[model samples]
Target: MLRFCPLSRIDGQKTFVIMERKGDKGNGKQTQKRIAPPQYDEAFKAGAIRMVTEQGRPSTEVAKELGICIDTLRSWLKAAGVQAGQADRQNRDSRRTRELEAEVRALRKQQAEKDEVIDVLKKSVGILSRP
Candidate 1:
């Protein structure tokens, strides 16, 4: 008479998994399997902050939507140089501002020159009329 010990069987599968008996005391040990965790990216955190700020979504809502903690979103915002209720300083000024300022100064100088010419013309007319 022979005794067979079965370990596991998959459903509808014609395969049998068996574990061998070991040791003088009849103790058997199974091998352990290892699983690796997923990798995280800081870019995802930055994207979450952009979504919340640019989309005008609430912090808690954005965190829930992204399946992350609210604190993580806050930290991401800090890293991206954005503050709550404050404009992003990095994007506040640009070459366009400098161009606009230069344009305004040039227009003011042109107007000042025109004003001086008009004053001279008026003085000549007044002098001619007095004679």
Candidate 2:
């Protein structure tokens, strides 16, 4: 249901131009709930694929063990060629892995720069403490 507010109340004119929110019930409607995303890592995905292909286990069983959705796991298998389906999860995984690796490399470089600054500060302090 959409409730509207009057656009112009002058000259006995009553027209609703603004629409209310969908969840507006009584005084004020509660905010919509947030849907959390499915979280998984590359290593975990490789393991799940291994379980289905190498061990000859069902995709549903593997998904149960990994605490992931069966359909999601099956999609992974289909991309990995374990089962017959149409989807290209491998390319997506490759891109994601590259992105993660780049982030890790950048973080490492930042840490090295900080370490150098700390070493320079320590040397200056030692030089000032002369006898």
Candidate 3:
């Protein structure tokens, strides 16, 4: 005998529901906490739309990546004042260029560290091999 329940109102506002098993005794144990309902946000929706359209990611995948549901992604796409398949390509291109530049910088830094290590090893080898 499972029962669906609603939140209790306290001070004119709803509070979280705590459910107890039907066959359980009134021993103040075996309680399950209710998860809060989802709330809508405009910015989240816009960002989801942007990720889907601009980043060329699917809505379902983007929703999962963003920790939101597919329905939530749809709602956001509706709210973002943009279509699902329309993204600013120039913006994405520029962003990709920046990302590539940053990656190159990181690789250059790593190469410099490796070069320093090689120089030290070379100096050590020369000293050890000298007459």
Clashes (backbone N, CA, C under 3 Å), per candidate, total: 0, 0, 0
Q: For model 3, what is the alpha-carbon lDDT of residue 106?
A: 100
Give candidate 3 regions above 4 Å deviation: 1-15, 18-32, 81-131
- Order of the predicted models by TM-score, top scorer first: 2, 3, 1
lDDT of 1 by residue, 21-85 (tens): 45422454453332232234867766777776666556677778877676677767777887743
TM-scores, all candidates, are 0.34, 0.41, 0.39
Residue 27, candidate 3: Cα error in Å is 14
- lDDT by residue for model 2 over 16-106, one digit each (tens)? 5445465556646433322244557788888988766655555666778888888888777767766612222444455578899999999
lDDT of 3 by residue, 1-131 (tens): 33446676544444455565667555756545565656546676667777777676667678788787777677667666755444444446666888999999999999999999999999999999999
Model 2 stretches with alpha carbons more than 4 Å out:
1-27, 84-131
Pairs of residues clashing in candidate 3: none
Which 10 successive residues of model 3 have the least lDDT summed? Answer: 82-91
* Model 2 vs. true fold: TM: 0.41
